[model samples]
Target: MLLLLLLQQLLLLLRLLLLMLLLLMLLLLLLLLLLQLLILLQQLLILLLLLLLPLLLILLLLVLQLLQLLQQLLLLLLLLSLLLLLMLLLLLLLLLLQLLLLQQLIILLLLLLMLLLLMLLLLLLLLQLLLLLLQLLILLLLLLLPLLLILLLLLLLLLLLLQLLLLLQQQLLPQLLVVLVLLLHCYCFYYYS
Candidate 1:
């Protein structure tokens, strides 16, 4: 009877050991499945990131192109404005040159009128003085005839000298060359800027 009771206890222990081994195997299977699912989730996230990278690069490229176009447009506008300013400056220069020419012409006209008046006054005075001398010579003909003849020759010589002086003009080629050089220098300055 005792042997039979011992055999029953051994069989119960064996059954309990077999049940524990089965539960361990099931736990291991569940852990392996959970690990595979985690790996798949990681792969899916990596694929999503890969698909989005090219789109982000394309957006960045578009933005850069837009910025470049804006920069070129701004540069073109600046150049156009500068060209307009240059045209305005050239027009102003032309107007200034016209005004200067008009002023110079007016001054020349005034100078010509003053010289003419001076020559006329000198001639009138010389004629009046000669008439007075002739009257004196008539009053004392014997003493003053030779003196009056010499004075008449001197008067003729003086008139010839005044005529020669009046015909001569001041030289102005040097001043004109200086003005041309200054205009060229100003043009170069603006072109380089």
Candidate 2:
């Protein structure tokens, strides 16, 4: 009887060991599944970043281009303002000359009217440029090409007007040569700048 009871107890212990081993194997499998899930998540995150990186770079480049355009526009504004001031000075000088020269009153009056028209045109051009710049800020890449063409055309018109003024000045008086030359220099500087 004693030997039989000892054999039964050993059998129970072996069965318990088997149950524990099965539990351990199940736990290991759970741990492996968790590790695989973590690895997959990490890979997905890397892929997302890779996909977004180029778009982010493109946005950054666009912002930099906008900044450069704004700077150029500001410079153009400054030049236009300077030109306006110079025109005002020339108008004042012409007025003084008109007062002193009674014999050439008719010619001086015509020149004065032309200069006034030119000043008004310049004012209109400045306003148009400002409007175009505002549009550029809003429209960005879509309007960029057309804005450039418009600016070029405006500059050409300005050059033509300047040439006309120079011709008039040459016909009117040699004394105005110095002022017209200065004006030409300013226009050249603005063009190069």
Candidate 3:
């Protein structure tokens, strides 16, 4: 009966040792898979940056083009206003030659002055519109700045994590290898004995 119990305990120890080795192998595999996942994430992030570069550049070009077009429109409006003023002046000179009454002359002059004031108001409104556009551009830059900074930070951190995982492998790999060798040796001795 004592021999049987000793035999059972021996079997149990061998079984437990085998279970431990299996668990260690599984743990090692899982750790390796995690390392691979982190590496994949890093590669994907790099690819995204490469793809996004051209898109960001195109957006910047579009903004510059918009600003240029706005300036050209403002110039055209100013030129048009100048042409209208010259035409009005010519008409008034004609009226003078045609012996228009003093009262009519006064009315024409007042009308021209009112038109000038309206043009000035329109110019002010256009200036305000331009200011608003500038403000919007600044706001967009402000928003984009943080996002770009965050992406940069994330990339940096991921790189650091990859290095850390490598370091962990360097530190623990030999120990795990030793443990596996020792367990195999013990199992072999037990089977032979």
Tell me the spans in candidate 2 whose CA falls farther than 4 Å from its real position.
98-193
Q: Which ten residues in a row have the lowest lDDT in candidate 3?
A: 93-102
Instruction: Give one digit per residue, the lDDT tens place, for model 1 in 47-87.
Output: 55665565566556556655655565565566556656755
What's the lDDT for candidate 2?
Answer: 0.64
lDDT measured at residue 62 in model 1 versus the true structure, 0 to 100: 53
State TM-scores per candidate.
0.42, 0.55, 0.51
Summarize candidate 2's per-residue lDDT along 73-126 as a digit string, tens digits.
786778678767877876777777777775586656767776786788688777
Q: List model 3 lDDT by residue over 1-193, tens digit each.
A: 9999999999888877876776677567668757766775787678668756755765676678668757866865786687678667866765675575557667667668767866786797678678767866875775576577568767866776787678668855665676677667656766764
- CA lDDT of each candidate? 0.57, 0.64, 0.70
Error of 3 at 180 (Å): 20
**Which predicted model would earn the best TM-score?**
2
- Cα RMSD, model 3: 9.7
Ranking of predictions according to TM-score:
2, 3, 1
- The local distance difference test score of model 1 is 0.57
Better of 2 and 3 by TM-score: 2
Q: Which prediction has more favorable lDDT, 1 or 3?
A: 3
